[model samples]
Target: MRNWLKIVIFLSICLPLSGTADEKSGDHSKYVRHVEQGFSAIFRGDNQTAISEFETALAIEPDHSEILHYLGMAYAQEQFWNKAADSYQRSLALMPDNIEALYSLGVVYFKLDKWADAVPVLEQVVELSPHHARGQEMLGKTLLKLRRYGDAAPALMEALTLKPQAAGTYQELGTAYLNLKEYTKAIENFQKALAFGPGRYAEPHYGLGMAYLRLGDREKSRAEMQIYQQLQKEFAEYERLARLTRAEPNNLEAWSGLASLLMSQKNYPEAVQVFQRCIELAPNNANFHHGLSRTFMALNYPKHAAEAAEKAVQLMPDQSILYNTLGSAYAMQGKRREALVTFQKAIELDSEQPYYHLNVSKLYQSFGNQKLAQEHYRAYEHLLSEQKAKQK
Candidate 1:
């Protein structure tokens, strides 16, 4: 319970029959030994070794329910949810009443985000093993994901009854209460979760903030939101130094980090402001100009984007990406001649860039240059086909 990551529910296997000296075929003891080794591997977090040992056990007894279940647990440990689901399905086919297999299969489906599939399998788990806290918790979480707040509330409450100290259960129940518009209950559960859970857990803080807002406690809501933001700022690697940028305005790295974080969060206008500040400090930084151009384009200010992109191109004439951005900005502004020349320049710099060819093809098509359009279009198709083949 202390290590939440130790969540996999593994199937326990019995050793081979003691008096099987004369009834053995191809060494049944060896299969049992491999299963034991697989179990050891799983305990040590060596999932690949566990997979191999389980696979060896399966080779001896292909229809083995226990071996299939062990292999599924190994796959689940490796985050191979699809393979884990398949292995559990095979195990279930051999032994339908196997609670371990049912629970594992449901957990795998949950991992795959197949909430509908998970619901029935997990429902059966709680039905058979009514006091199974983990099963109840998973079912509650899945139902919450599916927006079945009414059903989730009961299951989460039952899970809390089964495991009174579980912070995650409290957090999930808080979410359910929030969705049901029980603001007081939501705030209570969220506070309980924050009290018991790790300090870095941001979700409960966010939930508490929402609950406070709903209750018209604006000051408390703002306080909780500030805590949530501070937690997020600490957890995100790139955004860690964002606040430092305000104190040390000349720190280009801090400003760049903040700008990148804003850009990734799609706060394009804020990112543009940050990049402008960065450019003011370091005018020759080509990447900053390029970032500003991209942010401007994201904001659909093509003319401003073109000016910023042209500066980036001027600073780094050989960079294909700057030309591509400049060309796209030109195309957006209906400067067909300039866009065609720039797109062609980008292709000449890096013919392997598929987008450059695609843009040129579009530009040609716009001007009725049928021959050039066909040539570039064929090139773009060929590059895309090659990329797909490489992926395979």
Candidate 2:
């Protein structure tokens, strides 16, 4: 929670079964003797013997549900889920409706991602043994996995009511809310989840970032993204920083962002340098060249402006926007023919656009091509009329 890391997700599935050592050496009586000895040892601070003795007893009396349950418990104690599951299942087969065996089997199934299998068994256990925390938790988790969020919500809510400090319950509720796209609610629950501890949990911060971005708070969104980036930098060895620097030269954002920022600052030379760096870095980046061309125009460096504009045209020839940018750059450079050609290119890119026609008419008027000027002026007025009609 301190780091905004939500929760550590344990693998709820695939619980491994523990096995006993020195199993079944003598007769069934000897095995029973070892089992008794094992329980005595369990109480006497020797868990290894207890586990060993329990398995030895099971070997002697394979059908003894009581011994089977004990063996399963020994395996469960060691966190060996498969052996525990087998013993628990055998116990239930021998003595059906036994609540302990039912619960243990549910636990085994839950470990095995037998979620549907886990649900009914846990449901049955809860019905018989109401007010059981383990059953409720397991059922809630299984339901959560099945994406029955609405159904899972109440079960987890009940779990939190009983055990308010259970961190996993809050996390599950967060996941349910995330599934429902109730992002604000999800963020709240994820915050609650983080109260448990901090351990490689990135889900919450990312989710929060997305929510903030969706809510149109760019500052908050950026803050969360920064947090995520910081955490990612701390824990992971990534290679994006170099790539970003290479892409932007010296940028707090992409080329477009850097260009805009520098333009605002009126640091035309440094900004021009940045834009040119962008062009050098990404030779084929249409926007990069376009931005550099604009910066050169601002600096009154018409040669660089014309070069950058031509590069932008080469990169994205069909873009009417770039065509306009190039036309403007050419006009600034006193290349009347080049400017007129570029404006014509803009018109071809989008013939109904009045701006390109207006530019062309202005260019022709300056060049003393009165007939062409008049014709383009008429075209511009016609385009303006059509635009107004569309608006109406």
Candidate 3:
């Protein structure tokens, strides 16, 4: 259950499965004593010591599968996956039918990118309990990642039927539909996902927003974006921005932060309006022009983006990002020559941004300028390699 729920549900990160020995939580008395020790240690913040106590119980009752499982779970709570996986594996060895161990091991394998190992174990779980919603759901997601969309569909569908209320299952089904280009079905599932997992979930709504945008439902896309905005706001953030701007009404950074928050909330029209107001508040401010230009782009008013971009460039001739923004606006308007010139100017201004290079490469590729595109691709690759080397 943890494995099936953790992988697809948490997206590469697994939440801890620390079993509680709470007296009111379980029935096994002797097992409960050790579990309580582990729980107490964990709660008291002596996790490593708590882990040892759980390990000792497993040793005293060498055949106690439950003790082994909880010990593994304790290790997992501390993010010691290798130890956790080993404990789960030992539990499985003792009790081959241990679903918890199987599930947890699956998550560990997935986290380690041991997809091959994960697939067989999860498949076994699904086969053992064909109607288990979580098992089917996890197998479906794993299959999707393996690009077996056709095979993934039936399992995901079955999982949805059993767990109709699991928003994440719907999201996965939507992803499967998306990969298959089953747009109508994808949208349907996505909407269901929104109903289930919409609040505070970044990816589901981001996916739905993109899907609506693809279907030319701009208003729906904006609506989904509004939820993302609502979830992202914190009291601290609002207070921080307010303080940062209190003494600097004309501060470009502060104004940009406020503008960004408003934009995320899908107040695009207001964001555009506020940015225009900001530009007037500080007419010669390059950032205000930049902020206004982005707002116009979000509003899908490309012509306005172009004008704002032009103003930003005029004010900050050395800012490559501003030129890139303007170039995008020009490209959207099909002003090919202007886009090209501005893109070139942006590269001359800032030679390090791979995106700037990639943008120009894409434009050239669209125009069938294979030679120019290849040059830029090579440059981008070189930069990427250098960055990776630095990280090492």
Please, what is the TM-score per model? 0.55, 0.46, 0.48
Q: Candidate 3 at residue 162, lDDT? A: 89
Better of 2 and 3 by TM-score: 3
Question: What clash count goes with each model?
Answer: 0, 7, 0
Query: Candidate 3, which segments miss by more than 4 Å at Cα?
Result: 1-36, 39-47, 198-200, 213-392
Best by lDDT: 1
RMSD to the hidden true structure, all candidates: 23.2, 23.8, 23.4
Superposed model 2: Cα runs more than 4 Å off: 1-32, 40-51, 76-80, 198-203, 210-222, 225-392
Q: Mind giving the per-residue lDDT tens digits that candidate 3 earns over 1-392?
A: 88987667775443333233353244345555876787798788787878888876665456778778877877887888899889889889989887767877877777666767887888777777777787788778888878888878888999988888999888898888877877678888887887887344655666677678778899998987776565655435745766776777777677667777767666677678668767777899898889888888888899999999999999999999999999999998999788988998999998887777887888899899999999998888888788788889
lDDT per model vs. reference: 0.91, 0.78, 0.80
| Candidate 3 lDDT | 0.80
lDDT of 1 at 298: 96
- Residues 209-280 of candidate 2 have per-residue lDDT tens digits of 776776677798788788777767643422353345566565635555555656665657767767776766
Worst 10 residues of 3 by lDDT: 15-24
